[model samples]
Target: MTWHVFIKELKDSIRDRKTIFLSVLLPILFNVGLLFFLENVMMNEKVEQVTVAVDSNTDPVVISWLQELKELEVELVEDPVKVVKDGDALVAFIADADFITKLEKNEIPSISVFADPTSTKGGTTQDLISNVLTIKKQEYIAQRLADNNIDPLTIEPFQINIESISEGDDMSLYMISIFAQLIIVLAVLMGGLPAANDLFAGEKERKTMEALLMTPVNRFHIIVGKWMTISALSMLSGIFSCITFIIGVNLFTERLADALQLDKNIGFFTVSLLVGIIFFALLISSIQMIISLLANNLKEAQNYISPITTLAMVPYFVLIGVSVTELNSTHFMIPFLNIYALIKQLIYGIYDVTSILLVVGSSVVFIIITFVIAYAMFMKSKWVLGKS
Candidate 1:
């Protein structure tokens, strides 16, 4: 009987274009659009040129070198410091009046840089100038060493050589892991929403609740059937969204794909991630169903239920700054945060069986507790009919 109810509800949900669009198609489009926008617009854009004010008294050779660099545009000014303070340039360069004489005498000369420390452009300009000066200093040292008949290599100590055995780009894995986990969690809430709202609240608003109750089916069986339907749709939404996101990443962004790590442990990570999503799906489904059952009508249900997606995201934001290494087995016992922690583990290819087990065990306990509350609510005639 529960199977029959499940099949009927599933068919009805599949037939609703709105439901299908909300649950599956929207997530696919969102993932693809997000990847396209990030790849072409956000990530690929480059900083072209930074302007700086240089004092007229500065050395002509230094001024010419700065002007020759493709990334800098130098402006000669009498008061470089005043130009920078007045926001005329991103940075300013000034040197002591006898700077050239000091260099000829092999004596160190003072230099001053001025810029707004809080400005991003100023910071970038400062970094560029600093790098150029560093290279010039090294050249000056080499010339002095040659003049004294000393080998440049004699000044350097032993160098350290580093070799990495890791497979993927750390930056790419970090970005993909965050994007994938967020999409999956949001998909679960969205996918189950339409069915949960329509199953109970829509029926009440349409005056069909009485007909459903008149059937000889057990109330507990009805709740189970409806819960299973929501869970199945939620799982479908999450799985399809994840698939579309991966494919979108592969097809639209070759830069990320080339750096992606594909190894033996990928199988374990994928399976564990899927299992974690499934457990979360079941938990979210029961909770949504309970919210739906309590609402007087579809509008009230929507008003009450829509905030859940935003509420679900709070944990993601909280855990964003925390590193995976800082988390212990106790962290996996948490609800929304455990999924994030699991993704962090996958990012670094760390498979902690204890954390995985705790996630599964805690999820099961929450699922049972929520389903029991939903069952209790369903058994009450007043809640079932939304009267009191």
Candidate 2:
């Protein structure tokens, strides 16, 4: 009877193509589209060149250096400050009248830089100018040391070497992991909502629950079957979300390769991640089903279930500051935080069997608790029928 109910509900769910599309496909499209847009924005930022305005009195050496830089286009202007204020360039450099004399006397010369620090292009322009000036200062110091018959290398007491022993140099992997986990969590909740509401609340509103109860089946079995149907839909949504997210990440892998370390344990990582998502789906499905059974109508059920997403998101924000290294077995024992922490661990290629077990165990316990509550509700005539 339980199997029969599950199949019936699932078949009914499949017939609602609009619900499936809204619950599953919409999230995939939104997330993947956002990913592509971010990729383009970052690529544009990387190759963007800034124009620099230089006063006529600027030294020829400085002008030549700026022109040689691939990131800068130098334009000699009568008034560099005016050009910058007029938005003709991101930044301007003006040389003092005695700049050449100061250089000959081995004294510091004044160079005025005009820019709007509030803008991104202006910030980049400032950074480029600072870097060039630093290099020139180092060169001047080396020349001065040579003229004084001193070894320039002696100015530094010790040589420093930097070695990166980690697989990746940047935090891009961490960022991607957070995004993927959030999407999966949302997918699981949203995917089952329509079916959950329709199975119980919709049936009640449509006057079908009484007929379903009339069948010679155990009330617990009937509820279990409905729970399975909702879980299946949630799992489907989560799986498709995972696939879409993975494809989006792969599309930008080469572009982000230098900043992100590719995980070599992808097979194990994927299996574990899907396991976490599946278990979470089961847990959320049971909860949503209970809510559906309690509501008098589909609209009421939706109102009750809507806050579940926000409740799920609150943990994400709360645990956002918690790093993967800081995660312990205790953290995995928690419900929502466990799956979140688990995803973070998997992204960094840490597959601790203990952590996985903790997450699974916690989810199973919650599922059983919710299942019991749902079964109890189903057995009662008042709750099932939403009576006063």
- Tens digits of per-residue lDDT for model 2 on 1-388? 8899899888999899976795678878967875675556643457567888888877787777778788888888899888988998989988766676788798889877779989888987888888888898888889889999999879989999997555663456656666767887888888888899999899888888998899898887788888999999988888888777767777655544343344566688779989998999899988888898899998999898778768878878866787778888877988888888888787777889989999999999999998889888888877787752
Clashing pairs in 1: none
Clashes of each: 0, 0
Q: Which stretches of candidate 2 lie over 4 Å from their true place?
A: 27-46, 52-57, 75-100, 110-125, 153-155, 159-163, 168-175, 201-216, 244-266, 290-307, 314-323, 373-388
Report the alpha-carbon TM-score of model 1 versus the true structure.
0.79
Q: What is the per-residue lDDT of model 1 for residues 120-181, given as tens digits with 9 covering 90 to 100?
A: 87888788788888898889899999999999999887778897555656556666667777
For model 2, the run of ten residues with the poorest summed lDDT: 253-262
Models 1 onward score TM values of 0.79, 0.78
Measured by C-alpha RMSD in angstroms, how accurate is candidate 1? 4.2
Which window of 10 residues has the lowest lDDT sum in candidate 1? Answer: 255-264
Each model's lDDT = 0.82, 0.81
Q: After superposition, how far is residue 64 of candidate 2 from its true place, in Å?
A: 3.5
